[model samples]
Target: MQQLESLIRAAENEVSRQMQVCNACRYCETFCAVFPAMTRRLEFGAADAHYLANLCHNCGACLHACQYAPPHEFAVNVPQAMARVRRETYEAFAWPQPLGALYRRNGVTLALATAGGLALFLLLAIAMKGSLFHEPLAGNFYAIFPHSMLVWMFGAAFGWAVLALAIGAVRFWRGQSPGAVGSAAAVEATKNALALTYLDGGHGDGCNEEDDRFTLARRRFHHLTFYGFMLCFASTCVATLYHYALGLQAPYALTSLPVILGTVGGIGLLIGPAGLLWLNLRRDPMHGDAAQRPMDRAFIVLLFATSLTGLALLAWRDTGAMAALLAVHLGTVMALFLTLPYGKFAHAVYRSAALLKWSIERRQPNRLRIGGD
Candidate 1:
């Protein structure tokens, strides 16, 4: 308990110091929601820092625009400071606190978990078919594992991820002391979250990472990734509806809605995650917390692997390798869903909640009265 408190104090102190400096400068206030939110407070405490940390998008635009950055006496780096506290928040508010340790060495844990899942699925396949090499099974994934069995396995994992993420988001929201949110604010927040308005650097341009140069690559990639995941999810939902409602079975045609959506979404996932992984590697170390690299990379790699394997399975569905590819793809997907809560994916959930709070708070009159309209 004492150790946790100390960690919280350290994060809060760093965030507070940076917020103080940024508030005084107020040059980058137009860059993102974090600055405008920070201006609402004359002083910051643990809760305020926590709220601001999650509210930050860590786009690195503020750092590039800040005159007091680094070599300056203030040593202000908003993205880095907020990132540190954001990591702490993830650990502190994680559904199962003990499992939160996975954030550290997350890459190793993710790889091991994925390997274990793949091996388990492959073993099941071998047991079911009684052979490692089976004849081309066409598009009948149920040949290896029954649809009921697949539903039970993946349904449980997906349900758990949703529950854990919900609990964590609720916990964080309660901690922020958000008052009643107006309907307009709620709609605006939803729009901001879906569009990732803040990541656009508060303008149509883009964010800064390695240097002062602005680039829209990150925002575009994120759009692809987010929409791709959604499309894939929609495909799954449609497939379920077809199975239960329309009596459609496995191996929908290429022209089918489900297949088309999955194909497009898979492509987007490939490009988005690949681009994100590349940017993550090339990103400036000083922009965000360095220690969070493993967590970030773990999620990115899993997403990319999931999409890549799924696409491969689609392309080779009629080949003898189809069964093995299907197992590998299912395993990667299971890993992705299982680790969704504990991985860097939780950032989106928490950030969306923070945006809701910010939008509501912004509706309220600014108490600081620092920036005149």
Candidate 2:
């Protein structure tokens, strides 16, 4: 028991120390999205630390920015540190429920199921309205329902989901304690554990030039995919608002935006996954210890499948086939979202937060040092 307690104390101290080191590295400011938001504040505290920790979106810009610099080789892993903080925050505040329990466990399955159900319902409704089968692949599908209904219903739902998630995340951030461990001894333990983790490169070496190849590829693919999704999402939003709210029967060009956006988005989605998969394959996993887990591979494959199906639907325009592909695509998206809070995807939320925390924590002289001597 004494040995165990001592180890824990050592770990806490290490984490705290590394965090301080990261906070001192002002170079990270350029890459960190949250830096601008928190830099304006004169006073920094635990609350600020927690908030900043939650703000990091895990874009990996900081890792690239700090390469080849002093203390660059050191244990200042922004993404991992922020993820730890975000996990602590969520553990501290999320309401306990069966759904939450499921979310924590098999998030992918639950997400897939939810998306599948929604897609089925939507397809069924379209069929019942006799609007599922349409002429001229690019024709407007909203002619059956009042444009007002689509805008008020679909638009409001999407907007509300975004708002709610943002609010929930902020609330969670505000509720967490500064450190995972409460007492001084516990803090020390955490710091030591963090130190050991860094020394071993548990978060993996962020300094490798080879790794950058994959990282850059991922970034390019992601950028394409993101813009594609944004275009499609925005088109839907505009179409709904203009047709429903304003009672305007927009032309086929306006209504066909979803198809156009979907096609573009599909192309990006395919490019990203294909490139990433190639990169993942070409690398020597044994050399770098970069083996992806089955779940991770499954997720990637599902995403690729989703993209393929989306493109197929656009080409075929068969209601039944389109419905199936849409179901799969949405299921994959949901799985991605559900995995976000717990798995690797959590980095998106925590990385930004960590940046904020780093900005808030005052740097101490002689504390900066790279990992592994």
Candidate 3:
């Protein structure tokens, strides 16, 4: 904890130092929320650094546009600096503190969680059904494991994830109160977040992405990934409604609402994560902290795997392979739910919290005035 504290403070200080330089020039105010938010305060403490870091989309436009960037003494790399602190912010506010360290070794954590999930379900299948392989159950998922049992397992994991994320976001919000949130501010923040307003380089010309080259490739992939996840969630919600409200059971038709939603969402997840992984691999080393790549890619891979297994389960549901496929699908989902709180998934919550702060703060007047020192 002490070492992590030191690292966090160091990252905060670097952001503060860079903001001091940026405060004078204001060259990139049009780049993103970070610079404009920076002008509202002369100094960035832990709270300020964290808020701005999450606000940064790491679009790399500001870094590429900065005259004082690397190769000069200033060495001002806002994207990289902010990236480091944003990662630390995840750790700093993580619930169960010790579990927060999982963020550092996210790839390994993800792999272990995935393996454990697969093993659990596979073993459970054998214990309950007396065999891993079985005849087609007619797409009856409840045959191997009862719905109630699955509910208890997934509900516990999902509930814990939600609780942890809520706690962490509250911790972050408490560290820096953004005063009052007006209706307009709330609406603005929602619009920005939903539309991913910052990925456009603070304009509509797209982002400088990995190589400081302007492109909307990242933005499109992000939309696919985020909305894809949302669609999948909606599918689950719809299925729950069917089961409880309508007393309907599983094995919905391919044209059913739940199946349709999941299928479309699964396709988006496939394309989105594949594209994101490609971009992550090709990104410039200086664009962000290389150390956090594991965390980023781990989350992407899990999402992709979840969708892949789900679609496969749907495809093979009527076959003798249905039971095995169902186990694998359930296992992937179990891992995804289990690690939601401690992994890259938390970034969405953090970034949304930060954006809400920015919207409220931006509603107020700027207090700082730039001067040549």
Candidate 4:
């Protein structure tokens, strides 16, 4: 309790201190939403720090643009500083606080859990079919796992993920105490989030990556990954309707809507995650918190594995490899869902809420009169 509060205070203090220096510099104010939001504050309180942390996209443009960056006496690394605070914010506000610890060691835990899940599913497959690889399972995955069992397994996991995320989002929102949001503000935030506007560094150009070179590659990859996930979710929903409502079952034809959507989405997931992992590896160390690499990589690897296994299953649905592939894919998906609330995925949820607040705040006046001309 007291210790937790102290930890939270320490994070807030760091964010506030760095942001004060950034406010004084004002060089990167136009780079992202965080700067403008920071300007609104004459001083950063805990709530202000929390809001600013979430508002930050961690785009790394400011770091490259900062004259006071590392080796300088000021040592102003906004991205890395904000990132550390943001991680602590997630844990401090995480619902069912005990699960917050998972965020600390998510990398190893994600890998082990994913592998364990795969083994569990494989054993189940063996028990059901008396073999690892069954003959020509086609797309009738329920044949191997049974429809009821599949529904129960995924239903519980997905439900838990949703509930946990919702609770966390609500808690964060309440902490910020963002007052009533108008329809216009809501629309604006939706547009910003959907377009990832901040990732562009508040200009028509792109963000700074390694060596101060601005590139749109990160934004493009993020879009691919986001829309890919959406399409996959849509495919699942359509398939579910086909199963229960339309009397259709697994083994839908390649040209079928669900299969086509999943195929396209799976391809996007593959390319997106692969590109992101490459960028992460080559990214400048000072830009963001180096400690977060493990958590970031965990998410990237899980997403890549899920998509890769899913595509493999689709490709080999008519062969003996389908059963093994299906189990592996299902395991990865399960692991992804299970870790959603406890991993980097929570950042999206928290950030989206912050964006919404920003939208509303924008509608109001700028009280700070910052960016002196």
Candidate 5:
């Protein structure tokens, strides 16, 4: 515990130190939200560090632009510093204090979660019907695993993940304690987050990626990934409404709303994760803490798996293989949900919170700019 706390402190301190140099230089002030946000604080406290770190987006523009990065006495690498701090902040703010350490071993956690989920579902499928292979059921998945049972099981996992994320966000919000958000601030923050404004690299173009070059590849992929995930979620919600409200059961038509949403979303997930993984693999090692790459890739791989299994199930929903595919797909979904709170998924949550803070903070008076002593 002491060791973990020390690591967190060191990360925060490094960001604090880097921010001071950055504040003085202000060369990258327009680079992203992080710089302008940094100007709002003459000193980066724990709260300030946490806020700035998450807000950074690890875009790498500042690092590439920094004259002081590496080989310099100050050795300012803002993205890397911010990334180290962001990872620490996620662990620190993670709910279930004991589970916080999972962040350190996220890759292993993901693998275990995946393997465990697959085993559980596969075994459950066999136990349910006494055979891995089932008679043709025509895509009615409820035949394999009862709807109520899945609801209860997945609901618990999803609920826990949501609760953990909510708690963690609350803790982070309290840490920064950014004053009450006005309607304008909230709207602005939402817009920024939805559009990923910071990834713009201060120009309208895009942030730096593999080398000194700029690319919108990351931003585009991110959009596809999240939007795709949301579409899949929307499909689920619509399907649920159809089930209970409209008396419409599983095996909705190919042209139906639910299937369309899932299919489109699933495609987005496939393209987005594949692109993101490619970018991650090719990204400059110095762009962020290279150590966190495994965790990032793990999350990406999980997203890809989730989409792949889902699409496969959708494609073969009418065959005897539907049961088997459904089990694997559910297993993948379970893994994704189980790891949501403790893995790279937390990045989106924390970063959103930080963006909201920025939106609110930007509206308030800036003492540094006001006095100018």
Candidate 6:
């Protein structure tokens, strides 16, 4: 344990040193969602550091933005450094084995099962009322279920899931402590790194001079998937509210919204995994230090299956085949959600927290200018 602590401290120190040398030029702002918040002032400080740390979404935008090349560049590797901080935090604050285990495989399995059950229930309700194809083209498919029941079910399920995730994250964050020695400086450095990554824009030094086709494509796919999910989620909320809560029979056309969103989202999700799989297949993993993990491949395969199944459901909504597709789609979605806390998806929550932390750290006087082009 002592050796582990020493290694972590060394890593933190090295990362902090690299960050302090950063000039705050705000070149990577476009990639960072928290840039606007960090640039509220010109000077960087502890608060700003914390905010920046929490604000960074860890999308790898800043890494691509930096002009610093390996072996000679002073360029800040914000993502790596932030990750180090997260690691440190985890070491200091994460709960004991059994509790932490609850956030892992067992927890994910239970959540997936619960989500699958709920989705099955919803799908059944739609089928029983003969609403699945009630107005296939017109989009008013939601008119079949009891509005109140739909609203209550969806609302409660989403609320509970979100709450549980939030609680787990809070506990994780609260576990880290810098200790008394150089605590202030270490925390401040952490904040600065976060701000730099979350708030800086313009691709670091200048335009991306390196070959980043794969990276850019991956990022775009992710963005599209996010937008698609947002649209689907919004449509669900609207349907529930309009049909169930307000007691209004919305048009069949309303159903098309989620379908369209789902289709687009499915496409993006598929593209992302396909691209990654292709890259992994072509690359010689043994030749480089950056070899892909087996789990990475597993994640890609799962996402691909999820997207394809979803698209299949959308394409064959009327046939008996649709039932099987629907089952696969629901299963995959459940798997994705349940894997959230432990898999790469954990980055979604950890990255957001890191960004917010960066935002708070960089909150300094006389540095209120938002960084951007």
Top candidate, metric TM-score: 5
Please give the lDDT score at residue 214 for candidate 2.
22
Model 5 reaches what TM-score against the true structure? 0.96
- Provide TM-scores for the models: 0.96, 0.53, 0.96, 0.95, 0.96, 0.55
Superposition error at 256 for model 1 (Å): 0.9
**Can you write out model 5's per-residue Cα lDDT over 1-373, one digit (the tens) per residue?**
7988899889989999998887778888788888788777787778888888889987888888889999889999988888899888888988998899888787945655775667576768566767777778888888778899989988899999999999999998987779998999899999998999999898977978889899999999999999999999999999999999999998899999999999999999999999999998888888888778878988999899889989999888888788778877888888888888989999889999999998888888887782211
Candidate 6 least-lDDT 10 residues:
284-293
Candidate 5: regions farther than 4 A off: 116-124, 370-373
Better of 3 and 4 by TM-score: 3
206-297, model 4: which lDDT tens digit per residue? Answer: 77777778888998999889899889999999999999999998889999999999999999999998998989888888778887889998
In model 6, the Cα lDDT at residue 325 comes to: 50
Give per-residue CA lDDT, model 1, range 52-90, as digits (tens): 888888788888887888899888988998999998888
In angstroms, how far off is 299's CA in candidate 4? 0.5
- Expressed as tens digits, the lDDT of each residue in 1-373 for candidate 6 is 5765675566556544544444365554455444554345454443334334445444454565467623446746665555544434433333342333332233323544654675677567557756543334332223344446545654564555565557646764554232232455456545544333322233543112123322343344455545545555665566556566777664434155545565666777777677756654554332111311343455566667667776776666655444445545655666655444334444455555554444344443434333432
Tens digits of per-residue lDDT, candidate 3, 69-121, equal: 99889999998999999889989999988888988977846655775668575
Q: Report, for every candidate in turn, its global Cα lDDT versus the true structure.
A: 0.85, 0.46, 0.86, 0.84, 0.87, 0.49
**Residue 312 lDDT in candidate 1:** 95
Q: How many residue pairs clash in each candidate?
A: 0, 34, 0, 0, 0, 64
- The list of candidate 4 runs beyond 4 A from truth reads 1-3, 124-129, 370-373
Clashing pairs in 3: none
